[model samples]
Target: MKRIVMKFGGSSLEDGDKILHVANIIESYFKSYSLIVVVSAMGKITDELLKASERAEKGDQDYIKSFTEYIKDRHIKALKASIKREEVQKETVKSVNELCDELYKALTGVALLKELTPRARDYILSFGERLSALIVGGALIDKGLRVKVLTGGEAGIVTDSNFGEANPLMEATFYQVKERLEKLLQDNIIPLITGFIAEDQYGRITTLGRGGSDFTATLLAASLKANEVWIWTDVDGLMTSDPKLVSNAKVIKSVSYEEAMEMVMFGAKAMHPRAIEPAMLYKIPIVIRNTFNLEAKGTLITDRVQVDKDRPIKMVALVKDVGMISLVGGSMVGARGTAALAFSTLAKQGINIMMISQSVSEADISIVIKREELSKAVNSLELNMLGKGVVREINYEDDVCVLAVVGAGIKYIPGIAARVLNILAKEKVNVFMISSGSSNSLSLVIKEKDSKIALQKVHDEFELDK
Candidate 1:
């Protein structure tokens, strides 16, 4: 039997009904394929966990106590609704309570300490997936399937000690994961693993950052050499553009791994950008499908692209709520370490630069980052670069957005850039900064107020709806 990994996002497992729906899907595929199912926490549970952790760190014991009860009650309610077998329900609820009890203790420690270390934060946040995994496994068992639930770390995914955003040491991970999981596969047991949570070398709990579940799925696919990885989410697949912005935005039936990465970087929410790296390296194909709409063929992402002259531009992505900071100085002309210093300073502050452009004269460098990090980025730059003559003035605009056009053909096509600029110009949208790359993407910064208009204009100009 061919092995395959199926990952269901939080939205797909929102409640008891949804969990049953996912279980049914798994049942349909179980006999034909040697299956591994990775699942995220049921709807917004992670967010609630984070919020509760924050409250605990603020010494809000009352809120923490209530939130603990809320979590326990919620999971138990979902458990009762999903697992009809009394034995399964009793056992699963016991496991859920034990986890919830542990959660309460952790929150109490945070309340007493009033400090949320990265390690502690990761530990607290991990409960979401841990509890969900137990519930999901129990449901599957209730259906008479041989199910064994494991956390990402228990499944042999080992990463560095970066508590909140850990990265797997892939070489060791690939070997260890295969060695551990293949046995279960041979025994005809379904390995249901928790997504987003992994352990570091020191045996400490860590997270893979936002959308880490997708990362987990791809990593498993590459490790197991699975036939394919399927990511079941709310959306049909990667779209020509966000449907809210472009009413006629069509689902991209096929896209290259590189193009999908570009799209994700420019605000496509179908999958995390890092999730594709392992699959791409190993040449494993991934399919993004809608759990709700089974009829939709969805999107196929692979190492190769089937080029079509009619669809040169595969996607138009709009990244909103971004701020651009321009570091200007006369001494910056031909300056070697200026850009390096600026970037390093922000790195220390944990600020991620989304887009960057430099003047041809080399006198200024403009970087775009998330709007919420604007103040910290500006302060870090000012304190480090000011009075050194490296950066004379720092100007920033928080009300801006980035528009990106991505396709494998962009690198080979000549007039695509000109046509893109023309579309923005024709719409009277002021282009603040532009960055075109050989990586099959052309990005432009524009006023956030004009984001919708710009997206619609680009979508229509490319005739993506057709």
Candidate 2:
């Protein structure tokens, strides 16, 4: 039988009703294909866990106790509401109690120590997924489907010891996951794996960063060589623009991997770039669907796309809450390793530059990064490159955002860049920086105050809403 992996986002599994809905979706596919289910924590459980850890680190014992009870009550309540069988419900509640007790002890220890290491933080954050997986598994069993629950590590995903934002050691992971899950499939049992959290070679728990759960699903699909991967979220699919920003924003039916990567890289919040990488490498197609609007055709991301001749621009994407830094000096002209020096300086500080543009004269270079990282980036650049003669001046603006026009058809159209600039110019939105290349997108830094208007203008200019 063919195999498929289905991943549900936090929004899809927020409560008992939603969990039951997801179980129904799984049951519909179970008979047709050997299915594996991956899920993230319900609602804002991860965020709450993060806050609870922070509180514990400050030695807030009372809050820690309250938070533990909150987690326990929430999970147990959902468990009872979703699982009808008394025996199964009791078993699931027992597992939930054990996890909650462990969570209380862990937080109490942190409270007493007044220290929260990255390793400890990852461990605490993991309970969200661990508890949710058990509750989901119970719901499936209540529906008469044979279900097994396992954390990412228990399911055989081994990563390096990065603690937080850990990356899987693919070769080992591929071998182990296939060996472990293939048998479960043969027995007609579905393994509902906890997403995001994994273990390093040392058996310490770690987490993949944002969009980690989707990353987990895609990674598993690539490892198993599944025919396709489906990502269930709240939205209809990838939209032409943020629907709130553009009232007419429409779902994109299909896009190439490159186009989707560009959109997510340029700050399309609906998806993340890392989640697509594993599938792209193996030429596996991924479908993004809406759990609430299952009838919608949704979006398909594949290896290639048929360029739309009528509309070369597919999306108007925005990355808000960013800042731009400009470095200028006459000595920078014809200076070898000047850019490299700047890059290494920022790299050492662990600040990621979102977009970069250097003039042909090589005298001035502008870089875009997260607003919160601007101060550190500038300080590092000033200390490493300034007055030592290569970089004479450093300037920065924090209230800025990066806007991008993305599509596979961009390169095929002549003067597309000029047209985009003209559209923004008409709106009186000052462009701080521009970076366009052979890549499938043209990115520009603009004042955050103008983002909404700029996004709307560009979306309309491209007729992307159509």
Candidate 3:
């Protein structure tokens, strides 16, 4: 039997009506393939829960109590509207209350300590999906569809113990998933798997970081070797640029895996970069479609797809609040150990260096970090390598943003860099740092506030017509 994995984001199942609409879409597709649905929390539930968690972390006990009840009430209300059976209603309500109690206990601990660790935060945030899966699965069963709800761990995903940024264990996970899913298909059941949260070898609950549900879906699709993976969200598909930023931004009909990965990494809102990895690994095509607009074909992402070369750049992406640090020293020039020491220093401080570029002689290395960690990173580097011949002057620029121009076709084309810099220079947008690889992708760090203007200037320079 042909198998397909479909993932629905929060907005796709925000309300009762939306969920019913999702159910209809699933029903329509289920006959053609053995369906596995991955669901995120409904609407802003995760955000609301985080706000409540923050209040708890602030020692607001009364607020915690009220917020707990508010969460419980909200889920109960949504369940009431969606599920018609009295028995299922009672069971769901009981399950919801139990989950709330668990959350309340966890929140109380966070309040007493006035600190929320990533592990605790992941545990708290996971409740939203837990609650969502139950509601969605129960509702589908009520609609006469055979369904089973499974947490990410129960659904056979085993990841590393990274707490918030778990990495999947491929072999073990794929085998487990294949066995479980094959059985489910044999029993004629639709498995509604909770996205984002998985377990490590020790059975510890861990999340796949933010925007992880999409990653979860693709991983499952690859593991099960599904015929296709559909990411159903609110938007039609991957647009040329953010629609709000560029009103004329048009939807990309088909995008190569390389293009999609680069776009998401540099801030395209289509899907997370991690979501595409598994699909790319197994050569499975991913369809990004709107759940609300079922008639639309959405964007298909495949490996090595040919794109028109008329446009110099395929897409412009901006990642804001970036800080760039330039490490320069004459002694660092043509030195072998100097580069390793600089990177080791940042690694020791646990600061993630997003983009990096080095000069020909290795005398200067530029690294980009998050603005929030600028002080710590700078201080650590200054203390460790400032006068040690490894680094001389450390220049920090906090108000910078990274714009990436990504496409495979750009590799075979010449003078692309000149065209990009010319456009930005013409717009008077100063480029702080420029880095390009032989892989045909180029990235430039610019003033954070100038990100949008730079993006527009470059987009027009390439004449990316809708």
Candidate 4:
């Protein structure tokens, strides 16, 4: 039998009706493939938990207790409404109660200390997904599908010790996932894995950051070498532009992995960039479908794809609150190791550079970084290469947003830049800095507040609405 992995986001499992909708989708695919369903916490549960954590951090023990009880009641109510079998329902209720107790204890500790480290936050926050997985797994079993619940770690996802933003260690993860899946398949059990949270080699709980559940599904699909991975979300699929902004933004039926990555990297909310990495490495294709509209044709991301030759730019995305820095130095121009040294300094400081441009003489280099990292980045560069004249002024600007116009067909098109600038001009938005890659991805930095307006203008210019 073919194997497939399906992941549902929090929005898809928000309430009793939503859970039933997901169950129907699962039932539709179960007979055709050995299914692994990964689910996120119910809608807004994680957010509520974060608020509870904040209350605890404020040293409000009474408020913390009340908040925790509210969360617990919500989950228990949802579970009761979703699951039908008496025994499974009883066990799930007990499990969730125990999990809530654990969370309460963690909140008490945080309240006493009034500090929430990333590690402790992850430990406390993981309960959301953990409880969801248990509830969903029990509901599925009650629906007559053989199901087993596994936490993210038990599903063979191993990450580094980074409490948040952990990356998977592939070799170990692949072997571990294979072994577990083999045993589960033999037992005729559908594995319902918790998404987002994993354990490091040292056994500390770590989260893969926001949208990490999508990353988990892609990783599992790649490791299992499955035919396809389906990411079921609230939206139908990737659209040409933000539908709210561009009223006519249409769903893209298919897009290349590169295009999808660029979109995600530049603030497209369809999927996380890390979600596509594992699938790309293993050459696994991914399908983005809407749980609400399963019959609709969604976007397919794969290694090989054909593009429309007539289109100059396929999509326009915006990343707000960007900072651009221009490093100018004549001595650095044509210098054997200047670029490497400058980059090394930033890397050591853990500063992320989003885009870069160099002059023909290499005398000046312009780079874009997130606004939040400007001070640290400027300090690092000044300390590393200031006195030697190898690096000159670090001009920083915080009021900027990067608008990326991306498409694989851009190489064959002319006047793409003219179109983008003219549109922004029409909208009366000033372009702060402009940079385009040799790979045909054009990016522009504009004032932060003008980001949405700029994106809409560019989308209008490209005729994306059609």
Models 1 onward score TM values of 0.95, 0.96, 0.91, 0.88
Record all residue pairs in model 4 with backbone atoms less than 3 Å apart, i.e. clashing.
Answer: none
Candidate 2 per-residue lDDT, tens place, 185-235, comes to: 889999899999889998899999878998899889988899999999998
Candidate 2 deviant stretches above 4 angstroms:
none
Candidate 4 ranges beyond 4 A from true positions: 51-60, 112-117, 327-351, 372-396, 412-415, 418-430, 438-440, 448-454
lDDT of 4 at 461: 74
- Candidate 4 local lDDT, 1-466, one digit each (tens): 8888899999999987688668878887888898888889999888888788888888999988887788778888888888888998899899989998999999999999999898888888898899888888877877899988988888899999888789889899898988888688667788888899888998888889999998989888877788888999888888887787667788877787888888777777677887998888888888999999867888989987555655667788777777888888778767878778878899998988888878889888878888889889988888887888677676778788788888776666677788788888888888767887744478888887888888887787777766
Model 1 TM-score on a 0 to 1 scale: 0.95
Question: What's the lDDT for all of these models?
Answer: 0.92, 0.90, 0.85, 0.84
Model 2 lDDT-worst window of ten: 263-272
Worst 10 residues of 4 by lDDT: 304-313
Which candidate achieves the best lDDT against the true structure? 1
Ranking by lDDT: 1, 2, 3, 4
User: What are the per-residue Cα lDDT tens digits for candidate 3 across 170-286?
Assistant: 998998888777788778799899998888888878899888899889988988888889999988988777767765677778888888888778777667888898999899999
Could you tell which candidate, 1 or 3, scores higher by TM-score?
A: 1
lDDT per residue as tens, model 1, 1-466 = 8889999999998888888888889988999999999999989999999999899999999998999999999889888888999999999999999999999999999999999999999999999999999988988999999998999999989999998999999988898899989999999999999999999988899999999999999999999999999999999999999988789999988899999998888878788999999999999999999999999989999999765676679899888888999999989998789999999999999999888899889988999999999999999999999999677899999999899999977887678888888988998999999998755899999999999989999888888888
Off by over 4 Å in 1: 379-392
Name the lDDT value of residue 314 in candidate 3. Answer: 72
